[model samples]
Target: MPEENRTANFGRGVFVHDVVIVGAGPVGLFLACELGLAGCSVLVLEREPEPRSPWKADPLGMRGLSATSVEAFYRRGMLHPLLKASGVNDYPGADEPTSPRGVGHFAGMSLDPAKVDVAALPFRLPSPAMEGVMSNLEAVETVLSERASMLGVEVMRGLTVSAITQDDEIVVARAGEHEYAARWLVGCDGGRSTVRGLAGFDFVGTEPQFTGYVVLATIADPEKLRPGFNLSPAGMYLRTPAKEYIGMLEFDGGAFDRSQRPTRDHLQAVLRRVSGTDVTLNDVHLASSFTDRAMQTTTYRQGRVLLAGDAAHIHSPLGAQGLNLGIGDAMNLGWKLAATAHGYAPNGLLDTYTHERHPIGAWVLDWTRAQAAVMRPDPHAQAIQRVVRDLFGTRDGTTYAFEKISGSSIRYDLGSEQPLVGRNAPDLRLEDGTRLGDLMRDGRGVALDFSIDRRLHGSAMGWESRMRYAAGPARNDLGLGAVLVRPDGIVAWAGDRDPDREAFERAASHWFGSPAI
Candidate 1:
């Protein structure tokens, strides 16, 4: 039966691939891309007409990408066309090219190809490298789909998954008339995930308690806008007798409805209330509704059917964390699924997915929820969250903590019991002195041999083929004394001396699928 006119049968499933990903949003597409690079054959299905919401692909600072996410982008060699495909260049005239500098330039920061190596792409590209640049949401998703297809991933778009179930060897998913099977069925679907609903998983969390406003309209000279504004949520709105401009805010469980327009008076009042400004309003090109819904699933996996990305969690869009979180979920699960499909995963490795991700999701909810709480209408509370923002923004340790919450700072509690467990390795400098970020020639997991001393002969040290172990970094971006990485970019272990081989072996077994090499 054709997808558009077909009836969906809950228990019906067809061919099974190694892995089948539901949803083609950023997370689903990204997961497919990552697994393809990991050398896992994958199939991805999407019901949406295209990626992204109706809004033009907008870019905020776009931090919150996990170290794993960075690795995927690098492996894809994905840049170039993403920028041109999604956007029509707005020069803002010759003199003001960079004026919307903050708008598009910093905006492009999210997709900055220069930030990391192109080799981090999940699959091999004909070319070894490509420079990174900003792109729209739809454009980027399209690029990822293409890259995955090139990497041998099967993609099925315009297919809405209605149900998924698991047999001993595979998970079967159905979308209307089309049925598919896979050893693993992953829900990279959005917050309203169909797979999650079928599995009867609970999405436990709360919605933002406040009504926040975000304007996606364009300004004539965005260059004049200070990056300082995005630096923090302070001074969000400025009001004039006739005009009003407010800073970006989370939906905070608030609704952004096109039908609902704030009266010029209400807009001015919010500006006075938030930014203490009173300016006239001109072209209200677009107005919509949004609410930061802070929610998380109890677990990321169930039997052969697994969930990820927005399928696993959904929260406030504050800090642009939603897409970043989904990307990280894909990265984290991609390698694991590939390993499992290859029959390398330990008996219990799959179970650890939920144990690891659930806690992190809870932590994010607590942290971001507090961030929302502090940004209340009350002055005292607002000041408090501001101080916290300031503290986290400036201090390296604190900044790392925030990064951790964003998934950048996360390190797995790998059994190594090393200081760096559950963390990321500091950027390593190659022999030619290139940053390790430069070495990620396809985002494939690498083991670096950083052995400064010749005398350390431990069991874990022997598995040199899978990693790049070399002399320790001249400086540690993570402030970690030592670092051992999981292929998905989590710290398996870090220590001042050799890690306990037995303990390290436990973690390595998960990544390498055997005892220390």
Candidate 2:
């Protein structure tokens, strides 16, 4: 651990940290890494004593990373480690823009990646992190945990936050006989978040419409079920490449007793009904159930306490948005929170975390809701599914769905009319072969000045510690002379071919606080 991250004894006995995070899951750990990278003292608390779990391993724990999420890892210099941990030797099409190999599925309907018009995506750039990867929770957590440790972020397991108390100066989390204090408290815990409830955050959303289940069982008649996603009249069932893993969705209106462990008989019955085949489950190794019950905290913050990941919003794992959405929340909030912690943030900077992320969370919840509505096992739903299927058949329609699922369509309303101003800055490369991702590894905002005269150089030096300045002719300028990217890879501002130095300085001051004396 670094000297800066060490706990400081404020008084008689109380030790205070800069930020204390709950739930040492991927989101929590990732946020900790970001804060630590910015030299903030961070401590992460987890209820589980151990990190490993069967549910977080391969097959059952499989997850999809959106292109945007992959880029986040790339920016932080964790892309190669993440891909290696996920068992992928190399990602295809690193040097040039290309359509993705998979666009994932919608309401159990698989999308054809070939139909995705890569040319239609906004400011699409070719880079190593251009495409998404198939990974499991274990791999993601492992990579993040290692990086967090490297950044001097502390993780203490087997601590469950029982209570939370806060004031203007600091927040305290009580777990059993121990109390941990920090200037800020962030809840990255999952759906049944104790911090959210303790902090008085009002959660609101719709109820569940059906019960979904994932099971690992020995199938006596494996041939009875088709491979991959299967949408039936009764419901849907997915048979993965791993023969033992099975996923089924039944329109039980969320009435199935998920409290009790699902038995072999029940699993077989649900499988038969959903698959419309008498598939036999000889032995059930493991099973878990979920629902399309979409819910979200009305606000992400209450005083000194903030929430991220599933702690802020939750919905069905339809379209595999849970992990990616939580990752987006962490990436978006990390640097902003760090800036505020360092006491160099502009007015209302922390507030922007909620303003920016809440809408994205709501959109994800509604996205799952739409999928649930179209997969309700009714004539109306079937009709709608047919319509959606037809839409998926079109090139433009596939591209649209691809945009949403891959998170390429997301453009934060940064109050800028410039097309790329609020979007994730493409991996703009310089003639010297330096990419934007390489420059962001230190967790500082970057000013890419591509003007011939290097006009923004002197202005960028005012806030040297808060931003990195790189100047050169870009390989592809995307019609812009320069772009100011926030530490989280968001394009804060952009300049035309002439390049305005005043506008660039204003953007720098606006995001990085007043220029240093």
Candidate 3:
């Protein structure tokens, strides 16, 4: 760990990349794919020699994709491949979008489907993209890695970033005896991010309220344990549908040690105490611990270095928002960073990545904290939980929960009064029988004109290759004549029947920069 050891090759044979990403997890690989798709040279450095782990394979490795995440993948043409690999040909309730089955949960409270109002989510389509998809972490990472490799991204395994130093020109990262240089560096290395620590990013947030566990073990008497989520006087225990997967949350103020691998004896003791049953574990396959210790960096960017995923913010995986939020970060940052690297970005474009995503990160942290507070094994929490349970049974309450958990409620402040302006643009079907998302596979801004207004189509002409222009009739225009969508699928501008040339130009310039001439 000495400076001499970390500084083996300061300048010799330093491979230059447009963007050097640290970590090869789902977030890093997804970001690499996005950047590479935009024609940016990307190199991903992974500390692990191989990308295989029991905790990241199946059962315990399953992650739920929110509506926004599904749409993001669909827009990029990655959803079909991921779904095929995950063996989920279609999402649950895909045939019937209005099934009363729970789509997600808040803490331990299920988001009741009966309470959700489909009319409320106007932007949501009947396609499978609106529903959550369960995918194994290993499968997702594999899909991303394959897509990234096809896009010409270089990934080096077993390379740990020990030190990172950046200046005005480039950022240099040292991984053992080699040095890698890039115009921008991003840390997607999870909660204990080396890039975040070495780059001196200031992370601040609340401490842990409980210690949680994701265990895969054999039970001698499975009949003693209840199916699905169970809350006892000791703590909470959740059994996945497969029955071999179990999760326990202890209100131990995060006293559990994570550095050492958990033992079968320890797992049995905790499981027995929480489930209040004498369930004997025959064997332990995989065990990992987490805490409700929520934290996030004050700023996601520091000079030429940036942070995303668990590297920028972390909280308990109560509502399954961690993976969704990280994917959102990658989708948002990839295009802007690539544009900045390619010298086509408008002023403050790169900075918008942090500004737009920081608030969302803070909300998710507070969300986990609130869920932890309500799930505590105390008199006050129990009373609160009873009331929350009743609320979940109500229509408004369930709709609210779905909005936040599904990422459908998120809307950035794009300085527009229109509701759809800063939200995810609805997937529209054009007159040519093509879906709007299908056109966005190339990763570029889209100027959608539904009214066949020549003026609106002409508005995006100057932007040339940076923005694609399309005008046609749609199955549903939502009463909007036209709209401009960013690469990440967020609506940047919208208008009614009448056209505003100057106003349209202003919105275009704000997002895609001034006219080429």
lDDT of each: 0.56, 0.91, 0.85
By lDDT, the best candidate is 2
lDDT of 3: 0.85
Ranking of all predicted structures according to lDDT, beginning with the best and ending with the worst: 2, 3, 1
Which residue pairs clash within candidate 3?
none
Per residue, candidate 2 scores C-alpha lDDT tens digits across 360-465 of: 9999999999999999888999999999999999999999999999898888988989989878899999999999999999999999999999999988987888
- lDDT of model 3 at residue 490? 93
lDDT: worst 10-residue window of model 3: 1-10
Q: Estimated TM-score per prediction?
A: 0.70, 0.98, 0.95
Model 1 deviation from the true structure expressed as Cα RMSD, one decimal place: 9.0
Error of 1 at 66 (Å): 7.0
Q: Once model 2 is optimally superposed onto the true structure by TM-score, how far is the C-alpha of residue 37 displaced, in angstroms?
A: 0.4
Q: Over the full model, what C-alpha lDDT does candidate 2 score relative to the true structure?
A: 0.91
Displacement of residue 434 (Cα, Å) in model 2 is 0.4
In model 1, which regions exceed 4 Å deviation?
1-13, 51-56, 59-68, 75-135, 217-286, 383-408, 430-445, 450-484, 494-507, 515-517
Error of 2 at 11 (Å): 4.0
lDDT of 1 by residue, 197-230 (tens): 9977878889566455555343443433443333
lDDT of 3 at 239: 85
To one decimal, what is the Cα RMSD in angstroms of model 3 from the true structure?
A: 4.2
